[model samples]
Target: MQESKWWKNAVVYQIYPRSFKDSNGDGIGDLQGIIRKLDYLKELGVDAIWLSPVCRSPQDDNGYDISDYRDIDSMFGSLKDMEELIKEAEERNIRIIMDLVLNHSSDEHLWFIEARKSRENPYHDYYVWRDGTEGLPPNDMRACFGGSAWEWVPELSQYYFHQFSVKQPDLNWENPKLRQEIYDMILWWMEKGVGGFRLDVIDQIAKEPDLKITNNGPRLHEYIRELSKETFRKGDLITVGEAWGANTELAKLYSNPDGSEFSMVFQFEHINLDQQPDKEKWDLAPLDFLKLKQVFAKWQRELYRTGWNSLFWNNHDLPRIVSRWGNDKEYREKSAKMLATLLHGMQGTPYIYQGEELGMTNAEFEIEDYRDIETLNVYHERLEKGYQKEDILNSIHAKGRDNARTPMQWDDSPNAGFSEGTPWIRVNGNYREINAKQEMADKGSVFHYYKKLIGLRKTYEVFADGKFELLLEEDKDIFAYTRTSEGEKLLIICNFHEKEVPFLLPEGWSGKEEILIANYNEIAETEKLRPYEARIYRKA
Candidate 1:
């Protein structure tokens, strides 16, 4: 939108702060450890780093359960370390974006502590609390972790709302004072010279005072748009919202810089591929190829033209895409390279989760090895509900948020060398072969391929901020799109299927298309793609 649209060319690398590296050798990652890796990150060719969450917390949800807005968790070092990191990262021309967990805070947080003291406490209105309705939990709303949204607090003699775990109480944006507090935290972080934030469960915020007590309640954005005006007005502060139900229309409401709060909002439709069928209406639906094409097709076209889509396949919450969707073990290099080509070539800033470039997969662990608070609670609760352990395991296999939270695979050493001693979490079993050191050494490693993708975006502006025109919009096994600006045109052709299939070129798309990069092998001037192969071409 301006002469300095670097974000278009930006490659944002995500660092799970607890597993990134630990300077303290306490078997946990800290801020100083991140500082040590700044040079490596600069070489990694990222425009910025999005650190998950480093604020003060009891860490029930890792650091998402922030206990203090203004202070750094002693586990992550001091606020002074954070300031130093900002300076160092800026010096390396790399910006840092911290996670803004505004939806909730640890129950131990001062505000929550004050609010829970008594129903008449001055801070009581800062969180959502209600007299239980008809001897039941406050509402039928499902917590993302599991169970009802209301948690009975004996101290308050009533239930306070928690859209997540009981330790993390949802903030009441309905309270003007709480909204001001959020704004104050944003201003504080910005004043410290940090680049921006990735707002956690951001859409869960600005709860509608008029929110009907029902599933998919309406009028959430009416409140969010108003909150955007009250806060998030600074320039160059790129904030992205974590919103699962947002569409192009909702994105415009949150990112329409003329007034909205964030630079972009995450659209989780494509990532919900495992849940392709509506559980209530359809099962074994074959993921609806036409619908699949339509999903990403509509997202790319609508969000690109309407506002922006936060394009990503894996995050800290989901299992690694290579393992969950693609053939990381069987196809290995081919699939990892293919996925990288397809993802980064999309219309938004690409986020590469730690160790993903190495083609890392879900850890093979017995059910007992899992430590996610939500997963543990869900298993126990499900057991008490008469569900078979197999059924519970299947759910964990399908919906385990703990899968991606495993420690980063840095080397073949114990704990993946993520830490000197045992890590807070178990390392994936495939760590020896699928570690970062090997990826760096191999010329054909996924790490270098990612570097190539980042290089392509920076060296060629045609890949960024260009118009996206999907070809063969009806293809069930193929995803094809063209990015063009003036005389420059690039075709991103990808085969999502496992078997090799002949691809039909789009009308008026022919005549010596030079393949710039290929996932499987080099593409002839005019030839077909290999299985799981992807090609980027410029028409001659």
Candidate 2:
């Protein structure tokens, strides 16, 4: 069975290390802080933890810019602390998954340092470098953070390609020697007992003949196959690739049945529903429910037989799903539960981002209070291009990465119990009512609801191996689907709106249905669904 794999039945929790918790009063989260929370995660019912980058870095892009792949940064803790954390997590039966960034490295990395020295340096070919166009950059391609993708170096009389910030130069995967280095580093981590890796922007590793095209380069699958053969295939490791612009066909190739590359891939189509057409991510608009349903249906049906899917709404980079997709102000709890039910009921692995289980809302921080470099850079650029400050701030509120990066709310104490001192970033103001301490104390809160949802995934084999079929495909206000495996079939219905809606059961589906789960205290006794209500039923 495709879903029989260890990770397919596992509910993964993503932890943004810098914002999870702070130990030693540094006001920044650390390895020891994660150790302190292992029991909490275990209690929450997550089987694996995927940590954002924690390797040695200059922190230019919030730890994505790695300088040393072998050691932990002093900001997080020493390598010994990481080892201890891993051991502690294992004791709790939770696997640890490190975020691996193979596409690029910090400009301060030793390899990049040597590569920038001169053409004669052996490491010069470690990164993508080309001669300058009469002092101008080699191409007009824009990096993810904005500005030209190429940076010139006078010492080498050449420009280096950087797909992200200028501080993060793209690595040359064409160099077999560099690939060997990456493989060795991954093997070292696996030897330390890391259960798996979450590859960051993995699809961006291979570019076309020129540096302009963004994702899904020509040799992308070749590089992934080699990496998988050398690293992941050596063990029962779970690897997921973050393919930002990848569609179903490309996703299948990266995560095919042959186990050539990754166990699954994170696709961005559904999440980009609210992004304005012909505009950047900051240009916010309402999500089209029809389009959202179509994207999910397409991925579920296309990837069912050969590949796997990584189901997630909130992550380190995107804004909180409740705020972006649901009503954050009025129906926060209900909408959060609805979103969770819809996600977990799908035939894929579910990922819970930090604070998501507590139904944490987005931070309504003013532009000045935001800490994410991408948010600030985008804001300033848009303002310079004649966008009003208020409009830009509103857009930032709707789509800024800081919405998901705010300090995790543990309690109602100072800094929401995230830090004793001033936090690296501002904590959300509503933590007093939405913190985990409060939610865990209330059995009916979002925390306990998420626990139940996760438990269902482990208890029911159908959730893992069943074939997905979308129901009421044209319904915009409600999302309904069914999963059938063998003689068992489950019907999941979710009200995506804040108003009640009447839903009729599909034809040829008349039978005594057992209520498997629901967001409310009890399943509704009528055909009408409550606002933001969700229910799962199993047919005998």
Candidate 3:
């Protein structure tokens, strides 16, 4: 591995522009506020920041559906503000990665507008469109947001394809010319000194040529490999795919040097603790622990050969892992710290979302309080489908990933000090006690643990790119893995449960030990991890 590349062993902090900070006091966050807080990010000890999206968008999907690729939305600051932010972040040794939503464009995009205008229009071929056979969209595929994947374009009298919201139409990548358009835009931003892009829904981007879809179809990788060769070359950029269905073999194909595509791929399978991989098929029962241990162990062992995994517990799109995976009522704090220990101490690059450092969790919200377009749409769709109102509400409570996207907590003041006025969305009620201002002051706080964890990655070379070997995988609720490099080994042991557990160190591996990092209530030795406490034992 190249030691100089900024992306390697780097920790990424994701910022949702609308919820990060508000300078205008309009109850919405903008660029100038982020500029003022550069030092704050620096203190968090992250290598880079990835803003959700700041482009011109209808925000129906809250900036996921881009109307203009090059222009900055007015809600965010101007293009000049972005340029300045880049310069400011560079000064702090912090790189900025952008969210590249290339899978689709907003219905209002000029290209989409023209495409809908007439069948003979040149822009008509920019998106996927097909002739309707019998007053129905030509396929059985369901949209991610819960409806038909096809929407009728009355102006052109044809059906356009969209894997997500109908307002966001999928681009035709099979058209080589369209592929070039995306590549050109990528280079356009790279020229601006932007570091890289997190490709949204990469697995969904490349579908089969025959357009066969029943949940998931085969031949997905064939198209992705072809697309990778055409767009992402060997050098000049780093591409991280939001790949959902990638197995270890495919991961290696995309992440390895000869893999042709990107640096790493985000497989959410490990994070889907209680989730049914397919949404159309929701399993109401709670997750089985033995099943989870097997799942993660299999992934850790299998994916090691081909590609690097993207480790994370919370992001803009999912509910907090603590509340979902960990027993929130019984073991909130230990569970949070245990989850962190499991993720950060792993072999791959870890991404810590803005409030995740403080062990921030899902916001308690009434069904009516949700502002997420997708959640509301799902509720309505389920209701219209004759599902019980109670069942729909329960699904929202359990499966609503938007709960994690709520605004960050900066202070105990109103709106968590996010703004002087009402926020675009309500802040989590626990913000008063859980804000960054408070965590920075407290010694044993979760925020402090994050700072120490980040420092460990930078200070210890082994923790960053070290070899991870899964040990004691059979133990339920205890995730023990060894990371070693240069003949030195460090064992990371964590008890995921609130109850205490004992562990036996490997035989013939005795050495002088130093505690590099721990997440326990009171500090303890490496022989046994207390409750949610995790200890990293260093060899001397």
Best by lDDT: 2
> How many Å off is the CA of 179 in candidate 2?
0.7
Ranking by lDDT: 2, 3, 1
Q: Global lDDT of each model? A: 0.76, 0.89, 0.76
* TM-score (all chains, Cα) for each model: 0.90, 0.97, 0.91
Off-target runs (Cα >4 Å) in candidate 1 are 1-5, 118-120, 131-142, 151-158, 208-231, 257-259, 280-289, 377-399, 524-527
Which tens-of-lDDT digit does each residue in 1-540 have in candidate 2? 122369889999999999999998888999999999998999999999999999999989888899999999999999999999889999998989999998999999999999988898989888998897645877678887778888988877898889899999999988999999999999999999998899999988887427476578878889999999888888887889998878888889988878888899988888878978988888778898999999999999999988999999989888898988888888999999999999999988899999999989888887779888778888888889999999988888888889998999999999999999889999999999899889989999999999999999998999999999999888879999999999888999899999999988787565358888888886656888999999898974
Instruction: Output the lDDT of residue 3, model 1.
Output: 18
Show where candidate 3 strays beyond 4 Å.
1-4, 213-236, 276-284, 327-331, 378-395, 509-512, 521-528
lDDT of 3 at 409: 89
On TM-score, the stronger of 2 and 3 is 2
Q: What's the C-alpha lDDT at position 434 in model 3?
A: 75
* Model 3 quality (TM-score): 0.91
Q: What digit string (tens of lDDT, one per residue) describes model 3 on residues 1-540?
A: 222345666888988888889988898898888888889889988888888889899988889899999989999989999999989998998888889887789999999988888988888888888888546778677787778888886656788888888899988766777777777777677778786678888776655424564222464566566656654552345568887777777778667755456778888666555655565423455666667667666666666646677778778877777777775665666677778877787767789887888777787677788988767877887889899988877777666766777778888988888888788888888888778899889878778788888888887888766777877767886777788788677888777777777767676455347778766545654566566666678884
lDDT of 2: 0.89
Best candidate per TM-score, number? 2
Cα lDDT of model 1 by residue, 370-398, tens digit? 98876787778778988788867766755
